[model samples]
Target: DQQVKQNSPSLSVQEGRISILNCDYTNSMFDYFLWYKKYPAEGPTFLISISSIKDKNEDGRFTVFLNKSAKHLSLHIVPSQPGDSAVYFCAAALNTGFQKLVFGTGTRLLVSP
Candidate 1:
């Protein structure tokens, strides 16, 4: 069974608006959260990450929030631009030390002008 899943396969938003992506994990052992952005023919690039100890972590226009009690995490992008359109993947791990990660299928985000 997939431990991490993104229920919404796609999302659309207008330029300069906020976009929200969600992820859920079945494994309670997960204590680290990571978000990645991937473009066509390109490898997924790390966007942001959060430790289970913290409720939220923000970097520029990207923000990641974790709810340990609910086993859920979400990514928020403010003022999304057309260039921001890409596939977003969320991964869960026990800690950042190891390379093992359970990744969600991915959510395609489209930003329109």
Candidate 2:
């Protein structure tokens, strides 16, 4: 079974600091990894992603790092603000054939002012 795990259920960070969310997967065959942020009643919105062939991908305030050998990945948010507080999910899937996304339990981030 392909399992993605986020051991931490929640995290608290002071505003204007950096927040790092971690995720580990059991499937080495997974080719794609993604992160999403969700608010109270709204659906999850895509954050960032990294391909298996690449180790890191950065976009604006978000950066995703993939360690293929460890089957681990992490998302880093710099200068976290109160508005950045939300539930974040980590997902992994194959990019070929019938692609199916397997999601982690989710980590809720609290950016405190």
Candidate 3:
């Protein structure tokens, strides 16, 4: 089963507005959630993460929210930028001895100028 899912294939946002990306998960064993940003040809870069015990986590202009009850996750990029335009992926992992992540299909965000 696809444990993590991103329903939206793409989204467009103005350069200064907030961009909201959403994701969902089906696995209760996932204890950690992470967001990654990727350029066209580059690998996904780690953005932010939230523990299963925490509802939200933030870093600079990026914030991630998690709802364990609903098995949902979201990422908010405030004041979106043209440079912020990229493919965003949400991932979930169970931390036992090692971290193995199940990633959702990426959502392409176009932060237009």
Candidate 4:
């Protein structure tokens, strides 16, 4: 079973517009959530994270929201730039020290100029 799922495989948006990516999870043990942005040839970089205890978290133009009851989450990018075009992965951890994260397949975000 897919512990995490990104229903949309890709999203395209114009530059300076908002890009929204959605994710859903079936595991209730997950307590820490993270979003990673990845480029073509490099590893994913930690973009933002939200703990299950909190409803939302933000950094710069990136924001993440967690809904524990619904087992869903989303990442929002405001005024997305061309540089923001890449693959985004939604991941979750159980809050244990090991933090074995489960990742979604990934969503490709294309920001056109």
- Evaluated at residue 41, the lDDT of candidate 2 is 100
For 23-96, candidate 2 gives per-residue lDDT tens digits of 99997789999999999999999999888989999999999999888989999999899999999999998867
Deviation in Å, model 2, residue 80 alpha carbon: 0.6
Q: Give Cα-based local distance difference scores for all models.
A: 0.95, 0.93, 0.95, 0.95
Name the weakest run of 10 consecutive residues (lDDT summed) in model 1. 93-102
Measured against the true structure, the TM-scores of the candidates, in listed sequence, are 0.96, 0.95, 0.97, 0.97
Model 3 alpha-carbon drift over 4 Å, by segment: none
For model 1, which pairs clash? none
Q: Which residue pairs in candidate 4 have backbone atoms (N, alpha carbon, C) closer than 3 angstroms, thus clashing?
A: none
Candidates 2 and 4, the one with greater lDDT: 4
Q: What residue pairs clash in candidate 2, if any at all?
A: none
Clashes of 3: 0
* Model 2 misplaced stretches (Cα beyond 4 Å): none
**Candidate 3 similarity to native, TM-score:** 0.97
Please tell me which model should have the higher TM-score, number 2 or number 3. 3
